[model samples]
Target: MYIGLLSYSLAAIFFLVLLGVLLTDRRQDKPSRKYLLLATSISILWAGMAAFQSGKIELLFIYQTLEVLRNLFWQQFLLLVLGRSICAEDQSPIIYRAKILLYIISALMVVLIIDRHLLQFIPVLAHYIDPLLVGYLVQAVAVLVLLEQMLRNTRKDMVWAVKFFCLGLGGIYAYDFYLYSEAMLFQHVDNMLWQSRGLINALMVPVIGVAISRHPEWSSGIFLSRRVVFHTTTLLGGGIYLLVIGFGGYYVRNFGGGWGVIAQTLFMFGAIIILALILFSETLRAKLRVLINKHFFHYKYDYRDEWLRFIYVLSSFDETIPLPTRSIQAIAQIIESPGGMLWMKRDNNIYLPVARWHMAAVYDSENADTDFIKFMEEHDWVINLDEFEWNPGVYRSRGFFSLPDWLRSMQNAWLVMPLILQDKMLGFVVLTHAKNRRHNFNWEDTDLLKIACRQAASYLAQHEAAQALSEVRRFDDFNRLSTYMVHDLKNMIAQLSLIVSNAAKHKNNPLFVDDVVSTVENSVTKMNRLLSNLKDDVRGSEDKEDIDICCLIRREVDNRKRAGNTPNIELICVDEKIISTANHDRLASVISHIIQNAQDATPVSGNITIKLHKHINHAIIEIEDTGCGMDESFISTRLFRPFETTKGKSGMGIGVFEAREFLQRLGGDIEVESEMGKGTLFRLHLPLSRVK
Candidate 1:
């Protein structure tokens, strides 16, 4: 009895100190602070009564009544705190429903008040049920639900202020629920646990004091965090699940004939596995998150979480789907929408379906409806299909022209957000109904959606830009390859020009005429190959064949003689036949370019020499000329550079560069020795084919 007295006395004193502090504050009286003052006053009275009536059976009614009143007052305080946290201009529907529930709890209190009188008149009512005990149990449950919602709905930033308050209130109501529930089953309360209640309430006094200190006026606002609601929901669901499972086990044990123990054990394991599955299901978690966000939050979205989710979805590295499809997903996920489709404006002024995610295909094209585009550009509003259907004036221009029949026919179509960037609508995304069908999207939801859709527009813009850049790079490569074909054609034309000029003189010489025929045949074959290459890209592959360098160089020298006999040409050969593995046409072209260049450089009185010899494993062909020789600077720097020549407009400049590049491809190289006003030596190193 002394311990109970000490516990309640301590609780009363603790609450008295908290109340005095709250009253001392000079801050203007607010709705939340008034509720706190009332709750604190009731707590002191309840504790004082319990302390005084610790050993008296006659005063038990007063202490129990005080307990019930104390619970009711605190529940009201918590509910009001929940209300004051809403910063929205309009009242949340949740607050209205909670008030209705509070009225129901008040009715329970009224019944408890008159239950004793009714029992006195009937006397047999006590046999079936105890109204006082059941009333306390049900009221405790209602208070617990309020506390849970208080924690879940309060903004995360404001959680610190309300956390201790919810905890303290939770402890008081939880103790009452347990006491009353046990009393209901046993038809009597345990004296020991009843005595312990005062100590538990006293312990919560300091916790409540801490909460009051954190918020002197309860000025913090409410916006639900998904994390808090998800965890709270899981805890509440798990408790109910265990209770149901316990009842089922009890029923099976009473009913089973010989298999009670075995059936009960198997059932428990199966229930545990099923619980695990439910806890891990992503779909269930998504639904739970959406439900909590829809009902508990004052605002439609938690901006920080939504922004982070947007970034994560847009920038995800899962590249199996294209960016357009991911753009649809990024927008769809913002509202917990099931699926959506994205349309982009093409150059032909048509809105083409670029991507779809889990949504059925829709209208193929839009006729570029001028009013539709103008309305989206002007307002930039997210049109809610349901609201537009119910009242067309909500979107301002729904009467101008009805939505396309294809869009109207979509049974699940819910929202249409124009993917507007820089005041120009790039396209629009149509979202299917969200996971939470009861979602009454408001100004804030549309505001966030407009921003998200604009961001998605910018992302798709970059995608389009990237695709265009890639196409340009391909065109640039083709243009570069076309330049090479033109250079080859110029060289062939120069060869044929030399033949025409010398044909009048060489027509009388049998050997000279035969050399002309051979040269013309080579040119025609090369011209055919070049034309085939232009028709179908060869990608630089050519067949290599063994060619005799002595004969090849002789033929080139003989061809050069057809240009003019004035620049006397001499052939110096150490080996009659020297074979090297190379493409015949390419090697022949290389030889012709070198000798022709030598002939062009030497004057009529000047001499040109073609020398062939075997050195080590290579066949060396040297073309030496005496005319206007190049200095070391030009030969080293600009000589082999393509399209660079002293010949001006007449020179293609790619001949020497192309020759050296082709020779290198066959495991050979070209070396030059030249001096200004003297002569130039062009040495070709051709690797000899292996001796059989």
Candidate 2:
């Protein structure tokens, strides 16, 4: 088939398809769609006429008629798409006047075609003027106007959608204008240009189709389909394949001496196979998809999918995986980064590398410079190292500190995203070059990284908070155990003090010597218990057992009386055994502490009473002292607090706190009532153990 015939047939088919698409569209009522359909229909008619021109005067007239109509429709389409009005009420004066002038030109072209005498009337141009040339000039003007309108109306985001339309239509009109201007000057069209017109028109069909496919509102629901991409790639690849084969054949035919034909044939077949393999490769296809989406599409990511994956990575509770590593991995995945290192600020104002993902080159002790940290803290910028290096002046002008040599030396460092929480920079992560090298850090990338970094910072902060809390709890436990040991030591010292006081009088008594021996033995046992509690590996468990509360109280009272203190100490209790489940030594120690406190608080003339009784399911012990009584504020506020005291340097305030804690551990509690200048009452309640 002849090239001209093939080109014209393709052009006709393309326009018909466009016409059908517009007619079937649900939004044909839209002025733009309506004008587009009209323009396409007229274009089809013009191409059909031009296909059979064959130098016939009538056919030439028909072609020029359709050209005039096609130009008019194109003008209307351009105007409507550009948001210009042609209606009488809303039309601007320039547009209204231009429309009227177009109609006048169309009428004049028809008159000139009907009568050759009309050109003769313009005496100076009678021989030079041609109606076809005049019609082409009008079409060129209309196309130029359309191009200008498109340029003025298009936005950055809309450029892709309108670019093909402007290029295709503008090429057609520009060629026509050149051909007609040459014809008007030389009295004939160039044969080569005239012949190529059909092929050029056919080539423009695909470009126009792309423009329509990318129409924002018209193709809103239809994304860049996979099939469209596959076919477009195939077409482009086929063109390149043909060009390569043609070049190789020319080389073989001219340069290959005797084996030219054979070599040419082999080379052609091999090239075909190689090209086919490249087109079919999955890796190549994936790369192509990424490239097209990155360059052609407005958005680089499916935000919903990206957000869900990010959330999953951060929220994962795998104990073996550290949170800092997970945080780095989560953000790195967004940009297909191969490796990253997370740096966190320490208490000493140093940022140290704490976690790394697939990052073997980075050292654990890597620290960010104080100047760099200060700059990031103040600006909170996502530093793209490429930009920082390439355009250092831009950063320097904005008051950014110079990039550290250590950081710039890292070969793969692409971006540094600051992890800021609550207006403070916690740290930053340094990401290596993206796995997909084509992807660049843009505004969207920076925004997403900042948001993800905040979430990660929260996780890091929470992890740090938990660690600090755990340490605090450990110290609190050790301090508490130490306080109990000191209170016990205080009791032991008091016991020995009484022994020393009565040593001279009772030194010769055998019974008193036995009592002193028992007291010394008990003190040694208590010291060993205190030492055992201090060992880190040994945790003290309460030795809970049934105890005779009545005998316990009587023994404590007798020991105090033997101490020879001036205050009169008395025990009041039922003779019956009062048994309760409790730790024996802890219970004894607590009771002794209370009795000692009462003795110390009371004056020599004051009386200290100890009372024990079983009430319902509980045993109650009350110690009343007629000494310096506590005020309500002191009892409520300072009482039971470890290290707090009213007895000057002689008192270790842990006694009452330890007493209350031990009692509460055995389902018991202590209550105190006091009045200033009167006396103080202490009550201890313990759950009674059922008799077995």
Candidate 3:
């Protein structure tokens, strides 16, 4: 095989760049800096191999030692990277020791590959037993683990650039793993796999450049198209292989060999990872949300359907119902919070846990105590576990959790956010300590937590309003039913009065005329007044007109006399031509009803007096009677409700109700002030207009 000189040159250049990356990372934290150094060391070994492959063996034994050390550094690098990714920062010493073990293993492997006597394995250069093959395999796996961690920690609403760096670098590492594993284990390398690895390297150049330059969040939309092509090709390659296995099995049975097995394996693994990334991409999720909103009416406000459920839960005090935790957990996972609990205030004083989902059963309502309440009251903000200090008084005084018990459990809590509504403290949420992380929560995590908390609060508020609305609707229904029965009864009474009056008109020809006329007049008058008021009550308004006060007073007096009134109807008018704006039909009905009630209350011959006076902008009509007046209880409860009456024979209970309703519509009011024994005075206050 004619190994290209270009490969060696490129490898040497990358080795130098790795060294530069390591040198620049001197001031960085141990594990990250150490990993870079280890990567650099490994690059040096590969450079040695590259030089040796160019037919130079100046320090073959020394190069072998360096290769062994490089291999050992790689194991440490992988452990450190994985440990850091999982936030086991303090555990790197253990991993560093693991690297020492790998170094010894590498030395043994080197002796075996070079001498062929250690494990009966021959060292093959750029062939089946190449040391670089395993190195690439380990790197590829490390890259995949790093990518997974990056994706897990990424904020859903983060800018595209951070995501680009994460996915691009991740995708590259994954591709490199497949290519390295395939090339090293097999006799020949597939051109497709080789090209894919090259593409990954090409994609990684920009990512590494940006990451090193501290532009981790820069969007790489330019590469998105390229990635789509790469994924699509992976999918196609998988499909072709599957089709070959399913439909071309006869051809495979005759021609299948190592090449066929390798092809199928690569296609299957590549297709799965690529398709999984595409499907799980945040961009894809966002697009799905938009699609749901456009195509599905039920998911309009929230594409995830959580908002609607949150609304339903909020409007009621029914905390027994459960809510879906998927969206909340998804959000929490995105923000790197291992455990989350959402609390809502019920009835202002009591707090209830509405939702609780965690990576473990680390928190429960048992931890909710008086201290938690006080802590929420004192500091109504999001508390990040990374920044929070242990204080017994904070949660203990409020009875949230016992400090001793909490400490003994080795449970670490990182963030607590208060759910606030309109400046009133509602409740608070707590996030368990993040796993494998010591870096204080990032801004993206905080922002996302804030958003989720805000969303939960909004849902609670909406649900509460909905519950109240339902109650109001129930009250409205009750009022409607009561109103209907009263209205119908009033109409029936009116009809009975009419029938009595008709019989009275024909009484003289049949039987006792005086008794009949009196009975009919009393019934008819009572019924007529009740029905008129009922009509006003039903309409909820009155007909408006300007009426002459003197005329109305005289008419009332004459009517009383015509009805054989025992007590005289007295009239005192200050202004003869004083006119008042009123509903004439309603006012006449009100005046007649009042006079008749007054007359009934008076002794047979006791006097009833009416006075009409004009005050500034008001026509004060007063009717006084020496009748049995109302008590406090009568006036308070029974005066306004429809169908309440004092008179035994003619009281239909609609008079005052109608009178109040009519006067209200005419911009006036009727007031009654009466003692239990003294005469009653009914005063009608009407807005008066000066006569033209």
Per-model clash counts, in order, read 0, 0, 26
lDDT of 2 by residue, 1-692 (tens): 25555666677777886666656557666677777888889999988777767456566778777878888888777766665422445546666676677778777777777676777778677665776587778778787776777766677767777887888888788878887888888888887777677777777776676677677554423444655766687778789788978897889977998998889998888888888898887657756776665544446566789999998999899866667888999999988898898888865456766677787544333345566777777778888888886667656866785776668777788889899999899989999998565255666687788888988899889988986686567568868877988899999999999999999999999999999999999999998776545421222358778889998888877887887865988888853688998777778878888888888888889998888888888899989999889964466435866656787756656678788878877777788878788899999999899776
Give per-residue CA lDDT, model 3, range 424-523, as digits (tens): 6566665666665546344334544556666666665665576568646755764785587567557656755665776656655655556566655776
- Distance from true position, residue 409, model 1, in Å? 4.6
State each model's CA lDDT, in order: 0.78, 0.77, 0.57
- Candidate 3 residues lying further than 4 Å off, grouped into runs, are 1-4, 18-27, 83-100, 108-475, 484-692
Structure candidate 2, residue pairs in collision: none
TM-score-better candidate, 1 vs 3:
1
| TM-score of each model, paired residue for residue | 0.37, 0.47, 0.30
Q: What TM-score does structure 2 among the candidates reach?
A: 0.47
**Can you give the lDDT of residue 398 in candidate 3?**
42
- Candidate 1, residues 1-692, lDDT tens digits: the string is 98889888988998887777777765636777777788789889989999999889888777777777777777778778767666554766777787677667666666666456666765677786787788788789988998887788788887867888888878888998999999999999888888888888887876676566666474233222558657967987988998899889878877876998888888888898899999998657766877755444445467899999998889787746667778889888877898998878866566766678898756356755666666776788677888777767555534344677677888789998899989888999999998574366655677788999999999988878876786467557757978987887799888888989988988798997888888889988987876544432223337877778788888877776785555899999989889998878778877887777887788988998888898998889888999789964476446766556777756656678778888877778788878789999999989999866
Considering every candidate listed, which one attains the maximal TM-score?
2
